[model samples]
Target: MSITYLEAIREAQAHALRDDPRVFIYGQDVGAFGGAFKATKNLQKEFPGRVLDSPISEDAMVGMAVGAAIEGMRPIIEMQFADFSIVGFNQIVNQAATLFWRTNVPCPITVRLPFGGTEGGGPFHSQSIEAIYAHYPGLVVLTPATVEDAYSMLLEAVAIDDPVIFCEHKFLYYHLKAEKLPSEALPIGKARIAREGRDLTVVAYSAMVHEALVAAEELSAEGWEIEVVDLRSVKPLDTDTVIASVARTGRLLCVGEAWPWGGVTAEVIARVASEGFGLLDVPPQRLNAKDTPVPYHPNLWMAHRPTARAVAAAARKILRR
Candidate 1:
């Protein structure tokens, strides 16, 4: 039976809880309601006291998780929506992120954020906030693009001693699937070449990785060989893999679902330019969502985020240059 990206996440949590007694899940409606997106469905029944429901306050949820982590519990905090995570920004950045550095006590907490734009989700429900958390020093930011990565990376997040921002794209939950659960996976903080090519490299993560693959197939018909790299974790970015891809292709096109302002796309381009300037045959390019709040209209939402067509068009420019 095929396992979907969403199911992989839930299964990963189950495995973690079963393997470790210290692991517990906490979030709004995560108990009986099964989370806003049902990521925690039936988990409360399986794990009993380990699965818990929190108040509506995001800040309180994260704050309490931090405290639990300090007491040697591995807490998993699920934000109803990624945008709501901003409500707990202070607790995440100041408290959980810095706890280990300040006291040498590890904060082994994983915050699952269901992020990215969905039809009618609007600004409040749909947001790609990975870059914001990645900016912090101690936080490990992860964005899994495939079902396997979704399963392995989350398990890794829970096992990690540092606080982790697990950004699971809302768009990929049901749309992507795998034949079976993976027994082995690439380690976290590594990039995978989703599609290999010689003409240009398209660096992407999360949902954008799929879009880039679609764009690569389209470009291949036009005699353009496009390479697609999936950066599994935004923080601790796999610069070596990205720079090597650029070295082989000699052209780079970064794409992201987040806004254009200093997002992951920009960071990738900046790193490539600084560390591997001589490898590029042309100036690096990037594509991102428009600098505005996510719109409720489906058509507008499609236009706002970087789609397969948009990625292809952007790649064409880089390839031709």
Candidate 2:
């Protein structure tokens, strides 16, 4: 059946609650008011206290989830915004990520962060802070771009015993809609080549995947066939899949809705340059958000982050250069 991005996420949470008695979701506004983005709407009524509303404390809430996970209960902590998760830094990078190696206990904490720009949320709410968690050593990070993956990946995130920070592009929440399999799912860590070509490969995830697809369609009209690779799981990285695609394409364009410097694109570019260096025709290029805070004005915000035209322009130049 056809479902929107937000609906798919809700379905995933509902399905998980129904299937796993140990799995319980709790976060800010997630229980009473549904959620900041309504992702957990009706969950409280559907599962009662299982979908709990916590006081406004990102760090404390995350710590509680970690504690619960270690005690054999699967806790999913949803940070209202991606930037809000920054408040939980020490608990995440130090405690949640290091607990397994520090001792032998499994801390299966899943922190869901809804991210990216929309409605001029200013610097506070709309930050693409994936790099913050991506830099952590023991954390598993995944961002979903499609309806099926959005619904399927949550289950995958909960199944793994490791600490996971799943970044959901909130801007794409209402925009992306598709027919979802009633219950079938997709595996985590396997990057799907959404579109295939030989001239160049565009490796991107989250909202940028939609941008890259639009760019690819425009480029295809002009005779340039670009391959689109979605790095479904970024932490384990699926480097082999990216390298193989670039081996045939000869060029790579890594794009994302975060700052170019230390964002997700930076890691992808580094991997391709390091592992697939000799096979590339030119140095891999990156299309990403500018190295600055998101502005309030619509025109300025449009100019700041990478768009379809920007990605298409970069692809054309990379293909020729």
C-alpha root-mean-square deviation, each candidate: 0.7, 1.2
Q: After superposition, how far is residue 7 of candidate 1 from its true place, in Å?
A: 0.6
Least well predicted 10-residue stretch by lDDT in candidate 1: 312-321
Tens digits of per-residue lDDT for model 1 on 35-154? 888889999999999999988889999999999999999999999899999999999999999998999999999999999998998989889999999988899999999999999999
lDDT of 2 by residue, 83-122 (tens): 8888998899999999999988989988999988876777
Clashing residue pairs, candidate 2?
none
* TM per prediction: 0.99, 0.97
Candidate 2 lDDT score at position 76: 89
Show how many residue pairs clash in every candidate, following the order shown: 0, 0
Candidate 1 lDDT for residue 148:
96
Cα lDDT listed for each candidate: 0.94, 0.88
Model 2 worst lDDT window (10 residues): 179-188
